[model samples]
Target chain A: MLPTSKSCILCETEARKIYAAIFGGEIPLAVLNRFVVATQRLNANVPPAETDAYYRALLACDDLEALEVAARYTRKLPLLTRKFRLMAYLAETVPETQDFFINDRSNLLAGLWAAFTGGLRTAVKLPAGLWLLRRCAHV
Target chain B: MSELIIVGSGAAGAAAALALADLGLRPLLLDVGHTDPGAGPRVEGNLYDYRRRHDTFGLYIGEDLHGLSDVLTGETGIAKLNAPNAAFVVQDAARLSPVEASGFDAIQSFALGGLGNAWGAGLYRFVDADLAGFPLRAADLAPYFDRLTGEVGISGAGDDLTPFFGATAGLQPPLRLSYNADRFYRSYAHRRAAFLAQGIQVGRPRLGVLSQPRDGRPGCDYSNTEFWQDAPYLYTPAVTLRKLIAAGQIDYRPGVLVRSWTETAAGVVVDATDAATGAALRFEGRTLLLAAGAIGTSKIVLRSFRDYDTALGLLENPAVQIPFVLPASIGRRLDAQAFGLTQLNLVWESPDHGRLQGSLLELTSPMRAEFFMRFPLAARANLALVRSLLPAMLLMQLFYPGAAQPPAQLSLREDGTLRIRGHENAISVRELAPLLGLMRSAGLWTAPMLIFKPATGHAIHYAGTLPMTESPARYQCDPTGKLAGAEHVYIADSASFTALPAKNMSFGMMANAMRIAEAAARR
Candidate 1:
C-alpha cells in the first residue's frame, strides 16, 4: 500500500485540484506535500485491495469536473477518511484558507456574510455534487 | 536512611514533602516521573496569528496526528490530553498501571507532576458544606490553604464566590477575560438579583496561575497556548518538587514504580520496581506516606493486603458541558490578549440537588479541527461554520457533587489488575433546565443538541477510594490519616477523603496532605 513516486505525484495533483475546488485557491506545494504524506501514513494499514480501488477511481479522473466528481465520491467512502483530514489541514495551514474561514470574519457583518455565502454555496452544490459523484465513481 | 518515604510526586506528595522539609526533615519521594520530551517547536505569538503564519501543526496537533484521530473517530470530551507536547503527562500510564473498567473511562498519570501537569488550574478551597462527610472541617484546612496561596501564587477577585471558595490571604489580580466571557459576566451582574433568587452566583475563578512574575516564573503571557505547551507560571507539582530538590530538602527519585509496602517491626519497607528495568527494589523508612493519588494508592493498599474481594468505593464528579454563543460577539474581532484558562466560576445551591459548580471557558485555545470534523456537514461547510462561530463560542462545564453520583466500585483481581465498574449518574435535561433558563435570562443562548455529557471519570477528580472515618475499618484510615491495619503508614492523598465536593479537589488534597505530614512528623 506504500505510495510510489509516480503515484505520489498523481496524489499531489489530485489533492491540489480538490483543495482548490473546495477552498477557491491553490494550496502551497509544501503544505500539499505534508497533507499527502500524512494521508499516505494514515491509510498505510488499509487493505491493499481497498487502496488500489480508490487509486483506480482517483486515477481515472482526467478533467476538473471528473476530478471534482471523484472527490465527492471519495468523501463518502469510509476508506478515504484521509480526504476530510486533508481538507482540515489545509484550512488550518494555508493562509488563503485561513482568511476565508477565520481572519476575514473580524466583524459581525463580515461573519454573517461569510456564513450566508458559505451556507448558500453548500446548499446549491450538494445535490448536484452527489448525483455526479455516484455516476462518476460507480460506487 | 531517610526518615520518611513518600510514594508519588503529585500534588499531595509535593505538599507533604514541603511541609516535612519545613519541620527539618527530608523525605524520599519515589515516582515513575514521566516528563515532557520537549521535542516540539514552540509558538511565539497568539495561536490564531501563528496558525495564519506557519504550517506548524506538529506543535499543537502532534506530528503523528494524535489529536486528529479523536476527531476522525468521533471521540468528544477534553482535548488537552491529546495535545502533542502534553502527551507525556499521561504517557506509560496504561501499560504500567493497567485498569479493567466496565463503564468507567479511567485516566491516570504517572508523570513527575502526575495529572496536575494538564490540570485546568482551578484552585478553590472546600467550605464546611463541601466537607460534609469528612472528619474535619473547613477551619482545619484553612491555614494550609493560605500558606499554599503564598507558596504558589493564586489569581482571583473576592466577589460572590468568596462565601463558597473562602478567602485566601494573598491572591493576585484575576486574568483578563475574553469578549464572550466578559459579556456574560456583565450580563449576569446586571441581572444579579434575578440569578440570586434562583440560588446562583458568579465570580472570577481562583486559579493557581501567576498574574505577576514571582519566584523566577513569568506572568501569564496570554498567548492562548495553555493546552499546547507548559507555562512556567502555571503551578504543577513538579515545579515544587524541582525546587525542593534544588534546595536539597528532599530526595526525589524518578523512574520508580511503587508496587506495595510491608511494615516491619523495625520500620516500613516499600517494595517498588525500577521503571527502566524489571528488577524489584526495596527501601525502609520510619514513616511511609501513600500519596500516589486516589487510584494509585488504592491499588497499592489492596495489593499489599492481598485482598481481592473487598470493593472500595470510588467517587467522581458527573459533568455536563453546554456550548453557547453570545450573539453580540459573533462578528467582533478575536481577543488577542486573552488567557485560555477558565474565566468565571458558577456556584448554584439547588434545594433539590444541593450544590452545583460550573466554569465558563471561551473556546479559543484548542484547534478548530478538533471540532470541525465532528460537525455533520461536509468538510468545507463544517470548516466555514466553525470559523464563523469561533469568535462567539463559550463552553460551560457544569459539575455535579460527587457525593450525589451513583457509587462506582474499585476492586483488585487475582491477576494484578484493578477493575472499575462504573455506574452512570448523569444529570438529566430536567435537572439542567433551570440553569439553562437562568443563562437565557442573562442572554446566553444554547440548544439541547449542543449539550455534551461525557462518560463517567472524565471529570478526573477521583477520591474516597479508602475513606477516613471516626472508627476506621479494614480499608479505612483514621482522621489523622493513619491506616487502620498498618503501622507508621499514612494515607496522605484524596484516597482518604471522606466525601468529594463539586469544586476542584487539588487544593484540598494538598492541604490535607500537609496536615497529615505535620501530624506524622510529631510521631
Candidate 2:
C-alpha cells in the first residue's frame, strides 16, 4: 500500500529525530527516506492503535531521551517481539548510522572501555527503563 | 515417452540422472524449478569493504526485509533461508506444498538445486558405522562417492577426519581458514593429543567448494560473500543438472510439479501440475525415480496410495548452536579475504550419546544487522559491543544422531497437505560438557547459557520417511530402493536412507541415489 503523505511526513520527522538522538548526527535524507519507508512497511503489520501509541511515545521523548526510552522498551520487549518489530525494522534499515558505530580499526583499550561502559549503562538503566516502558507504552 | 522419469532435480535427482546417463539412458527430469532472478549486481570487493562504503541494507537484508522477517516473526533456525538472494530457494515451498507442523519446524525446497542452493557445502563421506542401520554398507556406495568427489570439485585435507570421512580420490586444496578459525585450529593442533585422548577430533572440513578452476567455473576468490550470493566456485546439484541438460543426457522440464505416480502394467504413469498454470498433466515412462526429498517424496507416496491415516517416522539430526569467542582475538581487525563456509569439523565420540558432529564457522559473512536486534544491550551499545566482538566470534553448530523415541512423524492430511508432529530431541548438557571443556582448554570460551538448541528439523537433514529395509513393509523401499507393492518405481533420495547420521548427508544422498539408479538400470 502506498504511504499517505501525512503519515509519511510524520515518519520522516520521527525517523530523523530518533536517528539524531541515537547516533548524534544529521540523518542523511537518503537514509531518512529509507527508514521512513521501512518503518511504514513494518507498521502495516502492526495494529494502528499500537503504532499510534508507539509514535506518540517517541514524540514525547526529547533528544537522547528517546534513545533511552526506546532502548528500555526494546530491552524488556525485544525489538523483534510482535509488539515492537517496527522498532527493530527501523533500527535495521538505518545501516548508514549503524555503520558509523563500528570501529573497524580496533583498539583494545578503546574496545574494553566501550564494552565496560555499555554493559554498565545497560545494567543501570534496565530496571527504571522497564518501569518507564510499561508506563509510557502501556504495553 | 522416455525410458526413465526422474522427479525433482535436487541432489538425488541430479545424481540419479547422471548415473543413468552413464548407462546410455536419458531420463526426463520434472521439477518445479525456482531460480534466482539474477545476481543483479556483483559486490566489487569484500563484503566488509562494500558495506562500509555503501548502504547495503537492501542488498544484504533484502529490499523487502525478508532477511530479518523470520526473526521478526519469531521463526527460529533456518538462517540460510533468510538470505535475500537465496530467498528463491524456498520461494514457493510453503504455499505450493503446504505442511501442517506441530513442534516440528520443517522447511522444504522446490528450487532447481533444492536446499543445496543455500547449503553450507559440508561434503563429508559417511563411514560404515554411520551406515550401520542401512542394508548396504559404506563399500556399496564408495565408488559413487569417489565419482562424485571428482565430478563435484571437493576441497579438503586428509587429517584427523580421514577415519570418519573415508578417503576419496581427487580433492583440491582446502580453503584457507579465517583469522579466528586459524588461531583456533593452531591451538587445537598443539593440544591435539590431549583432545584426541578425550575422544574429540578437530580437522579441516571437506567442502564442495572449488579451490582450483574446473569445468569453466572460477576458483573461489575468498570474497566472503558465500552466504549472501551464489558463488560460481561452490558446487550445487543444479550445476550438475544444467551440465546434463546441456550435454543432451537429460531432458529437463522446469515448472512441472510432480504430485504422485502409479505403476501401470506396462510402465509408470506420473501425475503432475503445471506450476505456473495449475493445469493437470500426465506423463508415462518405463521406470520412475522419486527424488523429491524425503518429505516431498513421502507426501507423493502417501497421496498415491490415498493413505492419510498411516503415519511414517521422520528422521532429522537434533542441532545445537554454540557461539564462542577467543579473548585474544578480540579487537583484531577483520580479514578482508577469507572463506566463510565451514572452516573446521569437530567430531566428539560420546560413549553415551554416540558420535556428535559440529561445524566450526567464522561469523564474518552474514550481515551484522541479523545479530544486532538480538543483543541484550541498548541499540548503540549493542552495536559498539558487536563490532568489537565480531572479529573474535565463531559459531559451532553441533548435530546429534537422529533418535527413535518420542518419534517425529510425517503423515498426509486429508486436505492434501503433509502434517508433521515433532518431539523435542534434547541433548543432555553433560554429554557436551567434555567437548566444551576440551575447546575451552584450546582457548575457545563459551557459556552454557549462550548455547541455543533450535527446535527439531532445524538441521534440515531430513530422511527415513520411506527408508530402505531388508524386509520391506508396506511404506518401505526394498534394499534395492524399489518401493514395496510397486513394480517400476524407485526411491532415489534420502527417503530411502535407513539411518540419519550426525555427518552432513548431501554427499551421501547423491552417492546413494547413484547406487539406486545403477541398480534400477541393471534390473
Candidate 3:
C-alpha cells in the first residue's frame, strides 16, 4: 500500500494537516472554503454527482495515488481556469508521487522549472517560454 | 598492432579509455553491455495509470521481501542498508562471476559500465596520508583527480571535509540537503566545538552528481529516483563512454566478456566468449589493461597464470551502520528535499585508532522500507507507525581503516576456477560504546547498534590484490600498474591499489587507471 499523508515523508505539511482534519470528521478549512467558493462560482448549479465524486476522490487520496487522481480529473478545467500541469509538477517533485511523474524529459523540464520557480507557482511562464523556443527552433 | 585492450568498461576502464583516447592512443573497450533498458516508471499514459502500473513501493514489498529476509537472517552477509536494489538497475546475472561461497559475496556486473551502474555516486580522493606507502603519492595523483572532477562534474561544498576528502575545486553546486540532513548538519554545526573535542568533524560529502545542468544532461531534479533509476543525468561510466564513442575516440565493442589472456612476444592475445551467442573470440593488443574490478581482474590473472595456484589478499574496510533519531522531527510531516544518497560526511581522528570517517545518509524515502524493516520492531505496529519513525531516522556508516584486518584470499583451484574465501572481521559491542556515546553527546538519540561484519567482498571496496610496490614481487605490480613477470600486461583497477583506506575507492581507482594508461601510452 502507498504511504498515507500521516506516514508519507514527502507529503506537504499543510496537505497532511488537511488530511488529518478530514479524517477526524472535521471539514478542512481550506478545502471547505475552496468548496464554498467553488459553489459560489457555480451559482448553485453544482453537479451534485460530479461534486460528490470529486470530494470522495480527494478525501480517498491520502497518498500519491489520491494526489494523481485529484490532479487528473481537475486537469480539464475551463480555459479561464488553471490547468493541472501544476499538480504534474507536484507529482514529479514530491517524493510521494510515482517515478513516472519524474522520469520523462517533459516532466524533468517541468521539474527543473519548478525547482527554479519555487515549486510550480511559476510553471506557466517557464513552459510557455520553452514552448515558444521549441516552436521557433523548428521554424 | 592493435593499440590497447580494456577488459571491463567500468569506472576504471572508462577513465583509462577516455584518457588514452585524449593522448592519441586507440583503446578497444570490450564489455558485456547488456541491453537491459532501464525499467523505470514508463512516461506513457497519465499519472494515475503510471502510478498503478509502476507502484515501486508495492513492487519492492513483493520482490524484495526475500532479500530483506536474507539480510535480517545474516544470509546476504552485507548490511541491509548498503545492499543495492539490483532489480531496479536491470543487472544481467548470467554474464557475471558465479562464485557462491559462504562468508563471501563478490558481485560483478558484465553490463556496459560493469558494476558502476550501481555506484552510489559518492566520489572521494585519497589524501597524502591515505596513500602514504603507495608507489604513486597523492602529489602525483592530484592532477588526475582535478581532471576527473572536471570531467565527471562533482557536486560538493568546500567545508571541513576539504582537507581529508580532497578534490574540492571545480565542483558543481551541491543539491539542497534534505530536511532531516539539514537538521543534523545544523546540530553538528552548533556543537562543532564539542564535536571537535570528541574527535568528530561534520561536512558535506563530495558526490559525482551534477547540481546544475551540464553537457546536455539535466541537473539532479531531486526526484529521489537516484537509488533505483539511473536518471541518465547521473555520471555513470556509460555516460563518459557514450561521449567517447560519440567523439569517435573509443573503439567500443559490446557483448564480449574477456575470459583470459596470454602474453606473447608481439602482443597479448585476449580470449573471450560472446555473452549472447557463446561464440569464442580472440583479440590481440599491444598492451592489455585489466580493470574488471579487483575480484574479476584477479580471476583473469589467475586463469592466465595457469602455472601456479596462488592465493592473493583482497582488502576492504570494516564498516558498521549506526542508526540515530532526531528528537525534533519525530512524528512530524517532513519533506524529503535534495537527493536521497549520502549527503554529509563526518570525519574525525581517534587517539587510539587513526583516521575514522562516517558517511551520514538520510533514510527518508518511502521506497526505503527494505532498510527500515531491519529495525526489530514490535510485530503489532501498523505501517503508519513504522513509517512515522522514518523521518527522524538517519544512518551513520562508520568506515574504519581498511588495513586493520587480514585481507580476503583469492585463489585458483585445480580446475582453473577462481575462488575467494574471506571471513568477516568482528567488531565487539564494547568497542561501539564510545561511538554511541559520542553521538549522544552531540544531542542525537542513538539507537541500539546492529553490528555485523560485512561479508568478505560485501562492501565492494576491496582492493590491493595485485598491489603496487617499489620493486616487483610475486602477485605485485609496478608503480605504473605493470605486472611483475608479465611485461605486456598491466593492471588498471582497484587490484593495483597499494593501500585501501576507509574511503570510497571509485574515484581513486579511476584516477590510477588513467595514470596507468597514460604511463603505458608513453611506453
Q: Compared with the real two-chain complex, what DockQ does model 2 have?
A: 0.38
Q: What is the TM-score of each candidate against the true structure?
A: 0.91, 0.94, 0.74
**Per-residue C-alpha lDDT of model 1 across residues A87-128, encoded as one tens digit per residue:** 565457555456645644367886677567766756655665
Lowest-scoring 10 consecutive residues by lDDT in candidate 1 chain B? Answer: B69-78
Chain B global fold similarity (TM-score) for predicted model 3 against the true chain B:
0.91
Every model's DockQ: 0.33, 0.38, 0.02
Which pairs of residues collide in model 2? none
Ranking by TM-score: 2, 1, 3
Give the per-residue lDDT of model 3 (tens digit) for B211-305.
Answer: 89988888887765565445655788888888898998988888787788988888899999887788999999999999888878888888788
Candidate 2 vs 3: which has more lDDT: 2
Pick the winner on lDDT between candidates 1 and 3: 1
Better of 1 and 2 by TM-score: 2
Tens digit of per-residue lDDT, candidate 2, span A33-55: 66676666666666666556666
Assess each prediction's global lDDT (C-alpha) against the native: 0.80, 0.80, 0.64
Query: Can you give the lDDT of residue B343 in candidate 2?
Result: 87
RMSD of 3: 16.1
Task: Show the lowest summed lDDT stretch of 10 residues, model 2 chain B.
Answer: B68-77
Per-residue accuracy of model 2 over B442-480 as CA lDDT, tens digit each: 989998877888888888889998889999989899988
Question: Which clashing pairs does model 1 show?
Answer: A107-B331, A108-B331
